[model samples]
Target: MDKRGSRRKSAARKDGASRAAADEPQSRVKFWMRRLVIWGGALAVLVALFVGLAVVFAARSMPGYYQLKATQTAQTIVVRARDGTEIVELGPSYGKWLTSDEIPQVMKDAMISVEDRRYYSHFGIDPYGLVRAVYTAATGDRRVSATSTITQQLARNVFLNNNRSLDRKLREAVLAMALEAKFSKEQILELYLNKVYFGGGAYGVDSASRKFFSHPATELSTAEAAIIAGLVKAPSRYSPTADVNAAVGRASVVLRLMKEQGRIPADATVDPSAVKLKEEAGQNSVRYFTDWALPQLDLLLPETFEPIEVWTTLDVGMQRAATASIKSNTPDGAQGALVSMDRDGAVLALIGGTDYIQTNYNRATDARRQPGSSWKLFVYLAALEAGYTPDDRVVDTPVSINGWSPRNSSGRNVGEIDLRTAFAYSINTVAAQLGNEVGFGTVASMARRFGITTEINTYPSMVLGTNEVRLIDMTRAFAAVSAGGNSVEPYGILKVETTDGDLLYEHERNTRSTQLVPDYVAAGITDLLQTAVATGTGRAADIGRPVAGKTGTTSSNKDGYFVGFSSGITTGVWMGRDDNVRVGGLQGGTAPARAFAAYMRYAVKDRPVEQFDTDLQLPEWQLEPDDEYMLGDPEDYYFIDEQGNLIEPGTSDAPREDPFGDEFDRTLEGDRPRQPVPGQRPPQQPQQPPQPQQPPRGVDGAPQAIGDDFLNEATGARRDQRP
Candidate 1:
């Protein structure tokens, strides 16, 4: 009985230990579950805090939606003629602002199709599109790329610059979301449509329709709408009037996208990007004037400028006449430029080229071409200022300055002519001799006094117009002469004001005019230039009334110019080949003079005929042997030589008696002459090149030297010459 009881106790103990082992595993599982719950909850709280901070920071960093008030009141620059006639309205002046409902459904469909097909389906941000953009960027595929949605583009156009950066992208995304929250879907679409720009100065869908189809946006066909929609990326590149083929090709891309997005029916297509037009389009005259005046805006207004009215000095009639005259008077394959200004320096009309839409290269303001004999006006003016007059006589014989001798257009000198006669004839030898006498420095100073701002090289050839100048600047100088010696600055904008009549800026009429050329000197030059128009090379520019002008023809007839003026107006005309090719000896007396005369006839017909202020007559002198002054060598100045080394006076490079000192100094006795050997052809000393012979020493024992003028080419100002 005792053995059986002991065996039962052993079995009971083993069963109890097995039960405890199973329970321990369950407890371990429960502890792990509790720990995981605590840690995951903590992580969730941290993530929530991070996102909240980012949202708060982003909201604080960006401007509020209410701050975008500029977009609503934005007006374009409306340029008007001096007579208050409208030439062009530059910005959003093409069409009236329209609501989203006023826009055609097809127009909206085309924009959404080409710009953002998934605009309605996504929230403010599209993650799938962003991911695809990133993938495309990574794969270096440039063709299939996505950047901004319509909302983001709206934000950029309204409030931000189109700068590419990670920070800007983040800000754009945040602002887009904010815009969506503040406005309804229809309102956002309205803003986008009203703010987008189409080429040819058309802004918004309504204006774009009128620009392309010459009708309201409410009546757009699928083809017309698609063509306008394709211009959002680059308005100038695909403007229909500028390039029809390009516009049609880009419209095809939009049509295909519209079909793919199911915005339009599969069969509905812009097969040919054709539309009905209501008017003859492409206003080149307005474009030419606006392009000339665009850069002046920054100096006239602040960078954060309000849209304002720019009342310019342009005359609509004169502008049209100028363009017509230039095109008609010029040759078939040549180009022309013209600028006209009143006596007070107001730009009455300006035409840079025959067709501005075809090319915006402004020849009047930007082209730097040689002025030829037209520059002789300054050389004569300088002589008059130095006591020489129109009656003064110069021997127009063969002349050369250094090695550059200029020949007359006639290729022969008319010997011994008065200053007025020489000027009227455009005699090269007489002009060069006078330039050498009075010095190039004085001539350059006179040129500057007349309002030339370009660098002036004072080489004697400069009197023959080796220096380059712009047509506008040359007109400004002539206006100064016409204004009785008052210094004039060429100006286009007469006044700038807000559309509501608030004065932003106005050109003040300061009666205190600065005098550049003296009245007497101006009168003298006017007398000579008047003779030029009456009986000289510029005779082609002669109007019925009294007129003064100068004709300019560059080497080989690459460029031709005729600048003429009357009592109240000064005009300049330039005709040339774009590639600088020589044309049929196209002298200034030919096409340029004809254009100048034609424009001037219309420019002055409205005003009464009057002579220039010629009350002040000047005394004349004669160039005599006893009193004649000549110029010395140019190597006296430390000018850069062909080797790029400074050729200075008293240096070995300059011809001198002895570059290095002799073996015996002045303090020691001079060496006796060496005797030659009796036989073998008398030993010879090395032949020394001829040295610069100084004039007979003066009474003060210094060598007498002729005076030569040197000028600084960088400043267009004159400097005193070394004796």
Candidate 2:
């Protein structure tokens, strides 16, 4: 009985120990669970605090975000002729900027339809859109849709750097949510419109409008608005300026989206006629001008603090006319240039070549071609300074210069002719002879003074334009003559200003020199050149107005030129093959002169009738006895001045004695008669003794006694002496 009781007690102890061990494990599990719950609650509180702080801080920084969102850099350039007419209009250089008011309703609807149909109804993150995007991404081979809301796009544009990473995406999400809370849906839409790029260097709606249609943003039609809105997805691929068909196709997609979203009424139809899509014309032309103007801007306002608006002196109508005339007149293989400037040297119109689309070589301002007889004006000016009149006698005979025989174009001498006729006919022989007599160095000096920025050869042939010159410089030189010899510097921009209307700088028309030629002399030269258009070689340049010009046809007819001026404008035209090959049967009088006339007809159609200033008048001139005859060897003839007075022989000092005076006659009598030497072989006259002569032969080869007897008996000499 005692043994049974002990076994029972041991069993009781074992059962009690097993129960205590099981309870200890349960107690340890409860303690760990309680600690875990406390830690989890603390972590939840910290996460909530961090999110709240981030949201508050972002809200506080909203103003800075808005400011950053609003700021943009834009590059815009406009080119105008001297008359304030636009040649080209370039849109901004950077991303576009548009105001909310300027965004068309159709454009707004189109963006919402294609990008985010439920943008207004959704919060920053749309669960339904996310699900749809995921489903589309999973089912389709390509990701064709996006779930990013308008607020997200704004957030990306404003605050996020472009990094495709999870951290960035998370930050974008957070910022987007914060932005949605800070700004209204309408504000987000406005920011989106103002910040998008529409391609072709156009940034916002305003720039796009001007780029495609040459109109303002506020004036966009529904079709145009739709086209621009569609470009947001892929600017370069869908740009109307780059690919019209693609742009039109994208626009159609946007229209369908609009219909699907009910942004357009069910019955409303998109009219194909409303789009009227055509390839944008003149945009490339404007870009060409902008490229040209940028370098000029940098040079003109190197230290400018603010953005500048360059108001050029270009006449759009005249520029178009010039461009069209060059294209129409120039042959297919040939290139040409046309430059027109006001009398004050302001550039009115400039056509660089047949097509700027093909090449950017600005022939008008860059090319240096032989001016041919166009340079005779400089030679004549030198003669005028030396005292030669337009009517002074010269023989257009074959002349040899350093083994080079300078011959007239016709290869036949026209015999004795006046300087005016010689210049009108572009007689090379006569011009060379005159150049030799006047000294080529003097002619070159005068040319430089008149703004010819080309190297001139100091040879007799230089008088026939052996040097190359630019069209712009030629136009400017002629403009100086039109301005009564006042030196004029060519200018395009008159002022530059910011879009906000702040004047950054202004250009003043500056005259470099006024002493190049006497006003009266310039006027007289202009009068003589008028005959070239009215009744001479340049008659083809006549345009029912008072025109004065000169024609130049170079050797082999390789280059043709016509440079002219009206009362208030000067223009120069050049036609030639870039390879310097001879144009088949082309002449300055035929092609270039006609182009000038055609352009001037349209350019001056609406301009007022104005004559060259009559205030600058030349003094009365009388022909000298020596000036009336071309007797001596061609090289022996001296250059006469405007008064038909010979520069006193052997004296370098500017001649003070008039060649027309009685004393000037005594200076001519010592060596030879005022008549042509007999037999084309000059007969040598007997030299008189230093003392008074006894009996002498008359200038006409008649024998007579000396003093009063010889003077009284020389009947032919007395008659010839009459002025």
Q: Tell me how far the alpha carbon of residue 344 in candidate 1 is from the true structure, in angstroms, after superposition.
A: 0.6
**404: Cα error in model 1, Å:** 1.1
Q: Model 1: per-residue lDDT, tens digit, 70-116?
A: 34543478788898877777765447777777888888889988888
Which ten residues in a row are the worst by lDDT in model 1?
624-633
Model 1 TM: 0.59
TM-score of 2: 0.53
For model 2, how does the per-residue alpha-carbon lDDT over 507-598 read when each residue is reduced to its tens digit? 87573557678776786677667767776789899998888889988899899999998857899999998889999867888889999999
- The parts of candidate 2 lying over 4 Å away from their true place are 1-74, 78-87, 91-294, 302-307, 511-513, 608-723
> Stretches of candidate 1 above 4 Å error?
1-74, 93-157, 160-198, 204-280, 302-307, 615-723
lDDT, model 2, position 320: 74
